[model samples]
Target: MDHEKVNILLVDDQPAKLLAYEVILKDLGENLVIASSGREALEVLLKTEIAVILVDVCMPELDGFELAAMIREHPRFQKTAMIFISAIQVSDIDRLRGYEMGAVDYVPVPVVPEVLRAKIKVFAELYRKTRELERLNQELEDRVRARTAELENSTAKLRESEQRRSMAIAAGKMGSWDWDWISGDWMWDEGQYRIFGVNPESFEVNPANVQALLHPDDVDQLRKAIAEFNKGARAYETEFRIIRPDGEVRWCVGTAAATVDDSSRVVRVSGVTVDITERKRAEERQNLLAREVDHRAKNALALAQSIVRLTRADEVKAYVNAVEGRINALARVHTILSLSSWQGAELSKLIDEELAPYSLGDQIVLAGPEVQLLPATAQTLALALHELFTNSAKYGALSTRSGRLTIGWQVEDQLLTLSWEESGGPLVMTPKSRGFGTRSLLASVESQLGGQAQFDWRAEGLLCRLQVPLTRKTATTTATGKFEDASSAELQRASG
Candidate 1:
């Protein structure tokens, strides 16, 4: 649409000056209204809407500043652009006065034709844009009033349909997609873009880029499904993997069907894709947990069987005590493993549990660096400690009121070395023969855990040292080879 011309008024007593401004600004394609006096300019303004007013400062009666003050007093011309032209030098005070009277700019004569034309052109264009904006705003308000009734009538049904679509998308983590094979058009909804971790503004959806997002192994699987669909398969569901822009791999299940023409030709394909990553991971965890449960059950049963078969006692009471003690030790370690989700058990906690029953006041000191032992290692260590504690209660440190015992361990170069020392007990002596308890301790530390054990017999007390190697799967240590002070340890306080 052609824009209507806005009027630019030039006011001056000299006809030649007014003519010159008209000649210069005529190329701007705006209507130039020339007036000989300020009174004539006011008359023109009342008749026509003037975008810009150019006035000579030295005019008779109504000078440029007076004319400006008069124009600004009228509300219709308050925002009009006014420029004052002067043949004389303007002082700072006069320029300030002109500004206060609503002058937009001042052009000193002889004025540059380009500068005059540029300033007028800017104001004229601004006026046109302002008028155009006002027109558009009015039109929009009219359209809104006309559609109010129609929108109100359809609001409920539209809201219901939207609610259903939103619920389905949220519950299934699903998104819809369409592809026009004939026109090579690919369309995806917001949910569809989100499933693939795509920024809709940045991603250009096309066949090649879509295929690129697929896992290389699953690309052939999807291709095979498409091939089957072409050969008279109406619908197909396939699970595939998509690698997102962030390099995260997610599983998705897509169910699609083709729109077949009368000649049995496929022209379009539409489908919904659901993210199945979490479901796939859950299934994997379930399978792994089942296998782990079976493996651990058999190991526990076999360990229990070994303790039963090897347990020996001359009397029924002793036999029952030995079997029960060993079995309870095994159960305690198993409890730790279960609490840790079978990941491992902490060394301090295992020792604390085994020694908890035989604790005395400040006589038994236990210290160890933080260490995590594998399930099997923890169980074996627990049994060995039970045997040692049983012997102490019967014949060693715990057997005497003045006896003192200290247990400390440290880790270095993936190896854990534990020291068990006893003192202030009845005089110690070497055993004439290795009993069932001694044999079982050796078998547990050495054979089961792939570690070493040494026993030292002294006149004062019995001392034992155990060295166990840690592997990636077997154990881990957080301490940097520093053993905690025996007095400061919480378990030490409990044992004491």
Candidate 2:
């Protein structure tokens, strides 16, 4: 039901044709981007997101088939709908060729406006649905991660409280009481009075008084245990709750032994009544934590399953490598989150870890103010960084000596903007085809983080800019690392 206008790119060499296409599509109420050539279209794609592409098949520099081939190579555009238009197309062979190059539909020169609109509408709507699905999946993943973090924190706190209670129990004394059956007299130690919340000066130490202090729910159970002891059970141990005078409930463990003469006639009963309230509470918390841990494990396994299912690769080896790399990125982020108890992770630390394998001392420069990323942000961004670093090491600045990579970020207006620039490597050239790595980089920043990513393939190197929206609480005012001012301008100057 919810929707937004999507971009539709129209590429043709003729200005008249471009105008005509625009006029026809303007009624669709979508943003139309015009390009005169395939190269121009590529430039537009690098800067903007085009949901459906309408390209003429007979351009001079790059024909429609060639252009589609190039576009299909890029993971980001692999699923993009491409409609090819040609003035002279009647052969089935040509149509087959177009389809092979990722063309969704082929339109002949004397195009029917109605047919064109209908076809484009279907593809456009499909694109919107696909993106919506992706956004929903991302939201689900983020929620699961946040919930897991909360459960983990609660589990940790419970464990700490349990440990403290255990220590106290070990060091504290137990309440002891002795009852002389023949004399009908009861004697209690100070510990017993304290455990039962009895006032030594006002409360009598008697069996009736003790029974009255028992919790209503626990009274019947205690009576049953005492009856068992009276029926020739020499030793007895039972746990029951006691209500203090002020109405506070506490758990207590009472253990007693009956002393009998040679005739097996009981003479007295002596028992120790210890306050085990903390221990009981600790056990309850431990059970809750166990259930939470099971839940967390399932969430994690589900996330891993999603990753495995969605990952794309051409061959088994490539698929394995890609999946392994992504899993490793998640694991690394998990470690970082664990260190902070899943509150978040440092941005600079994430960058460092991803780049460590390819880092070459001074060739790499990192500058950023302290920024704590939420668990979801940290995870998605870490994978994006890993792909960037892996690509750089294989073909960009980090691939060669005398090359330099500068990474810098700053927080402003509740957004974290980062810049990555590479220089001094072999003459840089834009890949004729993009791959899974590039796709991942785009998806992480744009779809997952609700951000923007820009790529400028300069002759010298590649310059990438990423801007991710941040919550107000994630950024902190701290001294910039490795730079006097962490602004983008200063970073560029420093790199130079």
Per-model TM against the reference: 0.59, 0.47
Cα lDDT listed for each candidate: 0.85, 0.81
C-alpha root-mean-square deviation, each candidate: 17.3, 47.8
lDDT of 2 by residue, 248-362 (tens): 9999988989999898877898988888899989999988777645644554555456557666677999789777876787788889988986778999989888866654889
List, residue by residue over 42-108, the lDDT tens digit for candidate 1: 9998999889999999988998899999999999999999999999999999999999999999999
* Residue pairs that clash (backbone atoms under 3 angstroms), model 2: none
Q: What's the lDDT for candidate 2?
A: 0.81
TM-score of candidate 2 against the unseen true structure: 0.47
State how far residue 291 of model 1 sits from its true place (Å).
2.5
